[model samples]
Target: MNLHHNLTKSRLRAAYLVALLTLAYTLSFIDRQILSLLVEPIKHDLSLSDTEISVLQGLAFAVFMGIGGLPIGRLIDRSRRMSIITAGVAFWSVMTAACGLVKGYTGLLLCRMGVGLGESTLTPAAYSVISDSVSPRRLGLAIGVYSMGVYIGAGLALIIGGAVIARLPVDTMILPLLGEMRPWQVVFVAVGLPGLVVALLMMTVREPMRRHDESFAVKIPLSQVFHYLREHRFAFTSLILCQSFAAMSSYTLNAWAPSFFIRSYGWSAAQTGHAYGITIVVSGMLGVVSGGFLGDHLVAKGFVGGRMSLMGAAMICAIPFAASAPLMANPHAALLMLGVITFLITLAIGTGPTALQELLPNRMRGTVNAMAVLTVNLIGLGLGPTIVALLTDYVFADPLKLRDALAWAVPMMMLVAAIFAGLSLKPYARSRSQRLLTQQPVENA
Candidate 1:
């Protein structure tokens, strides 16, 4: 009876922790993605091109995330992780709010860099924290649940932005102290302010115990982390590249789907928001969680490289849909194909991080995760949207041909992703086998 009671309490605690982290993640996405829904208005007001918007969405954010992630990840490994997350949430929240005040491209770009840097503190710490709190068997599902924030925040960004924009006039509105602000500016402030409350809530979280005792006794050097990667260079490189490609494919759609729908289908922002937003949230959440569970099930059945295998399979399955989705003349057909593609692509999101956690020792989790963050964000967030814009502006030289850009880009990326995933399998399995032979019992909270 006591054992059962203790188990229940522990599960409850884990649930709460995952819930809080997920909420922070969701808010981060909202702040990052709200700009997507406001692309047209912001472009009109700022006199910007699609290329400039891509820079704001991708490069500006990616560069800073790449810069900050490694250091922040190292801090998470050696310091009070909860404190780091709290500070990050606070910093990013303020930066997000500051975005509301930006009058031009440079200011907005700088603020976006700030937001990226602040958000860089999140996933590495959260991954390490959650790894310590849950048993290995549950790690994939737990992380999947946490990762749901990506889609949730994304969906909510559209939904909430849609609701707000629907109610407000498209023109500038005057406020008491703020004077005049555009609707997009107001949306930024509205989404950004709530993150402060999330930052406060994060303070209540206690840092869970490290999974290994030696993690407390000895400091792992950054040199050793790199050495380990070099030692398993094939596996690590393949895995990271595979994940980066997968992320690129997904981020491309997320960043541009609103604009695509508006330009191609003649849909209003609110209509696109309600339709596409609901599809993403539902499909993304289901896909992430299902993929994690499937990976876990496969691992239990003795496929040590199950996660990598699933990633390869997902990319291949998504190819047809990716090729077809953007090219559909009927908006309904395009949306249906997009929903299918989202489900398939997102299946790998949670698995990539979970796979990394399984390979690294507790001490190296933060730094390695940070590196993963850097690579994924740079390739995925930094380049994905930019690639599409370049294709639209330079290759097609016609903005209306955005669908052709997507049709060309997404399948090609997914093909590369599949190749990377296949290459990683043998090496990843070998590495996991070696690690498992010396694996210690993970300390569950």
Candidate 2:
């Protein structure tokens, strides 16, 4: 009875931790994504171009996020994850609020860079902590639940930012010390303030014990990490390629979708915000929950190949919706299609994270995650919007042709993503089989 009680208590604590961590994750994304919905207003007030906006949305964040993730991940592996996460949440919260105070591009860029630096600590530490707290059997669902933070945060940002921007006399707000601020600046302030509260909450969560034997010296130098990649070259390569392609399309659409609706269909920021925000919450919620459930179901059925299966199906399903996304003449129709695509594409996200965690031993989780994030952010988030913006500028020198150029570039990327996702299946399946074989109990002859 005592053992049962203890086990029940532990499970409840784990569930609580997952819920709190997921909420923190959601806040991180809200701070990151609010800028996307505010892009048009910022551009007009600051007299910026599409290319410049792309840099703000992509380069500024991605550079810091890429550079900061590894060290943060390393620290998380060695220290208490709760402390690391709490510090990060507080740092980014302040930086996000500072973003509202910036008077020019350079100032805003510096603040955004700070946001990236703080956000970089999140995933590596959060994943490691969750892995320790949850059982392998329930990891997919746990990760899926946690993953909802991304979409939910995005949804809230769009809805909240839209509502705030719509109501405020943002163009003429004169501060006692800072002079008149623009609507976008007001939007940033409104969106950023909540994170400070979240940061305080993050500090109160108890840290989980690190799983695995402490004396198991599995720390590979960076050189050996690369060498291990070479050993599992096919699996690593496939994972990177698949994730990169998928992320390229994902980030591009995320950054540009509101702008696209505004430019192509004459929708106001508020209208597009309400449309995309609701879709993200509804469809995105369904996709994440279903993806996790599906992955868990497949795993239970003795198909250790659940990650590949879910990813491949998601990529394939996403392609048609992506291809049709720009073709819809009505903003409503376009948003509906986009909602479907978001749901399908996002299904693969937590699958890769969970698979990598399962494939690698406990100690190297942070390093592997860092490497993955480095590649994904540098190649995907860093380049996706820039590529689309560049292509839109060069290919559509005529203003009339810009929408078509975006449509062409986005779908082609999705198709390529589908191909890469399909290619990853064989290597993922093989890796899983090998891992299972190695973990099997030895016979006592």
Candidate 3:
């Protein structure tokens, strides 16, 4: 009876931990994505072009986030995970608020870089911690719950930004000490300050016990991590490449979809925000959670490559929606198509990280996940928006032709994603087989 009580208490604590992490993750996305909704006002106030906005939206943030993840990933493995997360939450929040103070492109770019660097500490550590906290059987659902923050944060950002923009002045405002500020600047400050409270809340989470092979030497070097990746090169590489390509379309639409609505269909930002925001939250929540359950269901039914198969199938299904969504003549139809596209793209969010956790032992989880972050961010976030902007700016020579760019870019990305997912199946299955044959020990790979 005492054992049962203790187990129940432990389970409750784990649930609380996952909840807080999800909240923090949600706040991070709010800070990262709020800028997207404010792009038009910011561009007008700052006199920036789509190409410049694309750099701010993509390259500035992605480079730092991807590069910074490597060192932070190492720290997550060898250092105190909770403290790392707390410090990161505090730092990014401050940087995000600082974005409000910046008057020029350079200053804004620097603050974004700081935001990216601080945010890099989150998922690799969170994935490692969550993996330690739950049984393998329940991991898919647990991670899915945490991953919901992506959509939740983004949706809330749109909703909140829209409301704020509706209420506040888009033009410059002169305040006492702050002097002059635009509505977009105010939005940055508002969204950023809440993360400080989250930082404090993070202190309450008890560090999860690390689950690892007892025989494995502690603090394995980065070299060993690389060696292991090389040993399972096909599986890891294919997984990374497939997800990266899929991410290209995801990030592209995420950054520009509101602008697309405003430009192509003549919708107001507020209308786009409310409609698009609701769709993102509802569809994203359903898709990610469903993917987790579906992956777990398939595995339980003895499919070794269930996760990869689901991801591939999802991308293939998404190709038509990705191609046609932006081209819709009616605003309502475009938004409905976007909802479907979002659902299909986000279905892999939880499944992909869960896949990485399964592929590696605990000691290697952070580093390998960080490596995956580097590739994904570099390819997806770094280039997705830029590619679309370039196509509009150069190929079409018209900013209003953003829909044409999306129609061309997104379908191609989904196709490559599907192909890579297919290539990954056999190799991933073989890697899993080898690991199980070695009694699930990965230290000597």
Candidate 4:
């Protein structure tokens, strides 16, 4: 009876902590994505071009986030996880609100960088917490729940940004120090300030006990972490790079799908935002859930590298639909195809992270995850928008060519991602075997 009571209490705590971290994840994406909706207004106000706006949207934020994740990753492995998360929430939230106060492109860029750096602390810690708290049998589903924040936050960003833009009067003063600001500027504040509440919520979460972890090894230096990664280069490299190429394709869509609709179908930003945001959230929820349950089920069934294989299969299956969706003449038909593509593409997110935690020792999870974050940012976030912009600005040159550029770019990226993920199956299987062998002695002891 006492054991049962303690288990129930532990489960409840895990649920609440997961819920808070999920909220934090949602807000980070919301803060990150709101800028996408503001592109036109920001461009007009700042007198910027598509290329420059791409830099602001992805590159500027991604570079700093990637760089910052390294040190934070090491810290998460060693320090109190909730404290790192709580402070991160506060810092990013303030920076996000500060975005509303920026007077020029440079100021906004710096603010965006701060937002990125603050957010860099989140994923490693969240993953570490989830891995420690959740049972291995249910880890995939738990991670899936956590990952839902990605789609939910992104969807809300579009919905909220669109709603704000549609309803807000230009330059209405809310505070005395802040005079009249543009509607887009006000959106940043509206989205950014809520994170403080989330920070406080994070403060309430107890640091989850580390399981399947080292006794004193969390304090290992960063160089030693790199040496461990160096020992398993192929598995980590393929996993990170595989997901990155796929993510690049998704990030491309996230950054410009609204623009695509506006240019190609002559839809208003509000219309695109409403439709796309709804589709992403609903479809993405289904995909993320499927990934979590299916990945765990497959592994339990003795399918080696099932997670990587599942991600690869989904990406491959998504390719044709994502590629052809933009080229459809009928708007409804195109949107329907896009909805399908969105669901299939999102299957990768939930599986990959959970599988990654299973691969490495607990002491190394935070740092390696941080390295993965860096690689994803540098490749996917940094280059996705830039490549799309280059294609649209230089190669296509015509107003109607945006859809064509995406049709070409997205499929190619997915194809390469599928290949890399497929190649990783054997390495991942070997690594998983080695990891399982290490675990048996520890369990026996």
Query: What is the alpha-carbon lDDT of model 4 when measured against the actual structure?
Result: 0.86
Residue-by-residue lDDT tens digits, candidate 3, 377-412: 889989999999899888999989999999999999
Off by over 4 Å in 2: 176-179, 214-220, 398-402, 438-445
Which segments of model 4 are wrong by more than 4 Å? 170-175, 214-218, 440-445
- Distance from true location, Cα of 382 in model 2, Å: 0.9
Question: So what's the TM-score on candidate 4?
Answer: 0.96
Clashing pairs in 3: none
Order of the predicted models by lDDT, top scorer first: 1, 3, 4, 2
Backbone clash count for every predicted candidate, in the order shown: 0, 0, 0, 0
Runs off by more than 4 Å, candidate 1: 1-4, 215-217, 443-445
- Of the two candidates 2 and 4, the one with more favorable TM-score, higher being better, is 4
Which candidate ranks first by lDDT, i.e. highest? 1
| TM-score sort, best first | 1, 3, 4, 2
Off by over 4 Å in 3: 215-217, 439-445
lDDT tens digits, residues 254-275, model 1?
9999999999999989998888
For candidate 1, give the lDDT of residue 55.
94
Give model 3's TM-score versus the native structure: 0.97
Worst 10 residues of 2 by lDDT: 436-445
Per-model TM-score, in order, reads 0.98, 0.94, 0.97, 0.96
